[model samples]
Target: MPSPTRPSSPPSSPSSPALPPELLLLVVDAVLPPNPLQLLPASHPATKTLLSLTRVSRATYARATRLLRERCAFVDSARRLADVLLCVPRLVPGLPAVLSLRHMTALYLSPFGPSLAADDLPTATRVRELLCEVCETLRRLVVQMPFGSLDPLDDGHLGVRRTLREGFEQLHRLEEFVCLGSYPALSVPPEGNTDVWRLWPELRRLVLFGVPMDSHWLWWDIATLPRLEHVVLARPVGLDAVNIKDEYFHKLPRDDARLGRDIKVVLMDLVYDLGVVRTERWREIDPEERMTVEVFEVPLPFYGDETPLQLVTEWARRGALDGSVWRLGGTRVRGEEAG
Candidate 1:
């Protein structure tokens, strides 16, 4: 008959119970949206603060790691890229399983100091996998591989060529490709069936600076890209005097004549080099057709001498002396000719 032992009173709830570390991480992850980080705002305090938080606690470390690996893709340091790939599984295992690594699309590679050798192919392969895995989503690619003084005969060039060919092949989804320095020399023939043409079918914008202009006919291939609307050939060397003549106009397929028909602007700066000037015969071409060709000559000062404006003015004065039409007038310059 024992009055049934009264059940022990329920424990009183604590005023501010601590969140378990795992639960805290889950909360943080839930609050963060997995989206690619914008590269603008040259100076971002939030990014700096978030990077610093990774050092605070294990929970913060997990949260920060998830945010970075899921959103940011940078190639400033190869070692950093390696670290991110390797650490992703431990920090954010779910990311690799669910997210396409290539969606974080912009890539910047600098080969200025030394050529990337065959030994670097393993990491390059990982990068290629990441790129190809999300090829359907990539839009912009920026590569800065400086040729430096290496001879084309060296094994380094072979390695570079292989890497570039493999990498470029995977970037079939690229719309904008910017290559700085002199890697991936544009010696590929300008035939319609070339790999370059087949690789980027939708590329609309291309920027090649400080690279040799091996083939002016390559522009024909560029003109054929399905949706190419703008072309900016900057600092072109051998093909400066080359103009878009009727041959090109005719060669361009009218399959969808609308491709480059709307391309109303072109910017080119070809200096007066004897080899290029003599090799290319522009005067023999039809002036009436040439008159319709629009080109803007941008003055560049060699040996770090005068400003470009100064050079333009000097050339203008010289044109006046020679009784040539070359003066800054309305929407067009009166005397200065475009090449």
Candidate 2:
């Protein structure tokens, strides 16, 4: 065979076929979902590449910027959120009517210091402003209270609660409200009540992290949240913890009456000391009306000179001995349900 010859280089054109600007931008947007756009750092190589493309035409910039801001995550002081509002003043005008922080679908509010106190009003107001801007668009609001002596007094707690309640009223579209602090004062009103229920009419998921509650209140709230689907209440150590009584299920207003069938609830660290008694009671409730309780035991590690094998054996023994006794009618014992 003759020696292989290299293919001739394709001829360069003085002018190439140009795609319509709108169609080109649409193609780019179609290739990437909005999530990655939010995850990209401002100085990311990919972001720079997109920016360069935007400079090529106005349509590109419009599509790129819209995608970039669609799922924005801001973990800053309330003041920062306010600053964003002032920078984009025209974005928000009225309260409850139109939220200022509406552009964000997932919002995480983390106060820089201990507690969000009265002194933080200016920043909180700004946050409120931004929240109002995007109230209708917000689906998740996670408020993480800073650990430490943020609030030594009860007043600060009350203030925070009030602000949050007010915030909820505006977030009519909110589906999840996650509070990473003790907010026992925000207990749900008794069953058959609409006053507090109206505050979060559309709420579907509520997560309470590091909050201690009375068992009665916990079950009552679960029953009252008409549209609620998921609830996570994490208790702290050495508190008058809420345990799920077997009667927990019986107390639930008949599902067929108004609220739909059983609401599934997950209890973390349902410790034997506090939750076992209630758990046993829960087992006795009728299957049809009882609220389901799924318990998860946390493994606490002990510091000692025990060998790995010995430690594992001890752990396994502990786990096996800590089994839950289920009442005859309800679901199977923890960890025994069909996979």
Candidate 3:
């Protein structure tokens, strides 16, 4: 009987044939991230390199496709993204834009400034529907859409806001949701939108960079979300107690939540190094005043890079955040242990 095959090329051999599918996969894993589903963007050099390898050979193509899984999908272009997701899966859903991500799990989208959402509402609507269809299997989502005052949330001329709400209603399997830019989606759907929790039954982390929602909307049905764990706010620091009502903080449902259950609490920055989670406290304001909320990154995608908020939720449980948790009320501080 032949002995089991090994991974490395023999030392004496100056050259060797192509690596075995398993060995090639190992090499690919070493080059790319260990967990592609976390936060890698499609255009990332690592992702692009892996994508290139998919064309090496038929065997490598099969291996790469399994590895690809569209894990680190980045929607620099919504139309392009929709086109790919619509076709990548073996079985695509039947829809106007075609929905379904049979294998993909994570997604990251750059901000859809007014030019995209406002100039062409029809295209925007299709993209939104496609995303919802993909949500059937999507576990984690990172969206960087900062519409703020300009968002037509209140005005229904474009109907973009309503369309998103209805689509998000189908994101039942979504476990983690991250919103980039400076605030939650434009239309937060009044206080009652009962289906909010239904859409995200498994949600464990909800990080909002620049989530400046009013308290009424801030506390919306948070108590009903049974699985919500971390709710980090990146920008708009110093909201202190005055800006956020105490009732909102006390009402959060998951007391045994993973980390920073308090609404808009400035907790810690999670540093992902060597698989260990290290926390960084808030930066000082003007070298003297400490900011209550720590800004993660500039709201826009072009400003800087985006990290996985799940890193914060996963590692936040290990450190001591005593007298460090900064609530919206500008002054109150607590050393809440990660539950």
**Model 3 C-alpha lDDT per residue in residues 1-339, reported as the tens digit of each score:** 999888886579567676777887777777666543445556667778777876675555555555555555667565665566556554413312222345467766653653334454554565566666576677766665544544554435666656555666677888776654445454554643443433577886665544433455555544446666445554433344333323244454334352143323343332322121122222211122211233232122344344544344223211111112212223234222211
Tens-digit lDDT track of model 2 for 1-339: 899999999998789878897688777676443433133333455556665654565556556555544433445565556556765444323312222334667665664565555566555556556667778777766655542333435435435444534445587888766555434243223432232323676777665544444545555655666677656544433333434434244455555442445555544442343244233333334434334545444334566776432443333222221211111122223312212
- Listed in order, each prediction's TM-score against the native is 0.56, 0.61, 0.61
Q: For residue 19, what is the lDDT in candidate 3?
A: 72
List the lowest-lDDT window of 10 residues for candidate 2: 320-329
Model 3, CA-based lDDT = 0.49
User: TM-score of predicted model 1?
Assistant: 0.56
Clashes of each: 4, 15, 9
* lDDT, candidate 1, at 303: 66
Best model per TM-score: 2
- In candidate 3, position 64 carries an lDDT of 54
